[model samples]
Target chain A: SAVISQKPSRDICQRGTSLTIQCQVDSQVTMMFWYRQQPGQSLTLIATANQGSEATYESGFVIDKFPISRPNLTFSTLTVSNMSPEDSSIYLCSVGTGGPNYGYTFGSGTRLTVV
Target chain B: AQSVTQPDIHITVSEGASLELRCNYSYGATPYLFWYVQSPGQGLQLLLKYFSGDTLVQGIKGFEAEFKRSQSSFNLRKPSVHWSDAAEYFCAVGAAKLIFGTGTRLQVFP
Candidate 1:
């Protein structure tokens, strides 16, 4: 299993502003996933990042709205652009441990509040 | 399309009482099930997962889940509920990309 260090555990930003959340993994991984958990809602996949490649966004999400950067195997960043009150949610990063069972490790998550 | 369903939105139980949280998932291929607990202001922690072999799997915090393929269900169970066990539990199904259930919020009363 890998441990992830996420920055800005939480933040409050005004509408129309952008916030970038970062996740650093202790071990190298091939793919990292970004998820959004809205208040009182289940988690939804935002995008999947692979090193040196553009992220693959989910159907409802877009690259412009939620840009992702996977600079290397151990680090990734997700930026929420043009924030709105609706953008307020908890963002999480996860990496899968390749094996027979394929276990996944998740970051602490960033709680963002757009005013 | 893959999906998960957690019927219970909230569940309240007394300390030391047995607890069960229901979960159901729909997927075309062999399903990989997982249970995760999320505490307030904390990260999601894996409680248990079922990939193959035995149907019943034990997890941390004395939690266990039984995967029933015929029923398309993976329900979480605990012999005795603890106050610290109060949290939101999510059931997911998938390998690389997961589809999560709505989640069940447990409230333990001492």
Candidate 2:
């Protein structure tokens, strides 16, 4: 099992401002993913970050809006740019470990509120 | 593409009563199934997973899930419910990339 620590547990930002959330894992992992949980909605995958490679984003998400950085196996960051009220949501960092059946270990999550 | 479906959007159960949350999936082959629990303002915690072999798999917090291939379902069960168990539960399927269900919110009443 891996322990993921995410910073800025909760933050309030002004519209047009940007916020970057950091995730640090205790153990090195091959796959790190970013997810967003909007108000009263299910979690949606924002992007997949592999160390030393460009992040792969899912449909409807662009690198310009959500830039991801995976510096190494144990560290990654997700930045929400030009935040708006719609960006108010919980951003989660997760690491994929174990085998094919193995599930992911997630960070506590960052709650962002845009005013 | 892999997708998960949770039929019940919200469930209310009495404390100490048995509970069951249903999950169904759509995938080409036998996919990895998982159940996760999320408390208010907290991250998701894995309850159980079913990859292969035994149909029933046990997990932490006294939770268990059964993978029924015929029905394409993996339902989470608990013999008894606790007040602290009131939270949102999600079902996910995949290997490297996971597709999560809409989630079911459980409300335990004393």
Candidate 3:
């Protein structure tokens, strides 16, 4: 499993501000996933980041609101743009080892709070 | 479409008691099942996973899960509970895109 280091474990911002969360992996991986876990809710996939290409966003998620950048195999960043109270959630980054037998590793997660 | 269901929202157990958390999933094709535990202020940790093999699988921290294909269930179990085992448990299905169930929060008491 890959180890991920996520920055800004938590943060509080104004309603109109934006916050960018970062994840750096200790090993190079083919794919990196971003997820949002709303309070008292199950985790939801936001987007999938692959090196050298634009991210693939989930149906409910838009690149405009949740832009993802994968500059390289070991680094990725997710930005929550034009934040609102409703956008408050815990964001997580993960990397899978490529099969059902191997599980994925997740970052500690960033707890975002919008005022 | 793939989905996961965790029937229990919260479970309480005494420190030496046995524990079981139920999870059911719906997916087409060969399903990949996983159980993850998340402690407060920490990241999600993989407890166990089932891809292909025997139904019974053992995981770290004395946790085990049995995969029942006919029932589409992968329930987690432990012979004895510990206060440190208190956390949120999530059941997910998929290899590339994971569909997670609403987690079950375990409350362990001495």
Name the top lDDT candidate: 1
Error of 2 at B46 (Å): 0.7
- lDDT of model 2 at position B85: 96
lDDT of 1 at A17: 92
- What does DockQ give for each predicted structure? 0.86, 0.82, 0.86
Write model 3 residue lDDT over A51-75, tens digit each, in one string: 9999999999999999999999999
| Superposed model 3: Cα runs more than 4 Å off | A99-101
lDDT of each: 0.94, 0.93, 0.93
Off by over 4 Å in 1: none
lDDT measured at residue B11 in model 2 versus the true structure, 0 to 100: 100
iRMSD (Å), candidate 3: 0.8
DockQ leaderboard ranking: 1, 3, 2
What DockQ does candidate 3 have relative to the true complex? 0.86
> How many residue pairs clash per model?
0, 0, 0
Give the per-residue lDDT of model 1 (tens digit) for B1-110: 89999999999999999999999999999998999999998999999999999999999999999999999999999999999999999999998788899999999999
Candidate 3 versus truth, CA RMSD in Å, comes to 1.2
* Chain A TM per candidate, in order of listing: 0.97, 0.96, 0.96
Ranking by TM-score: 1, 2, 3
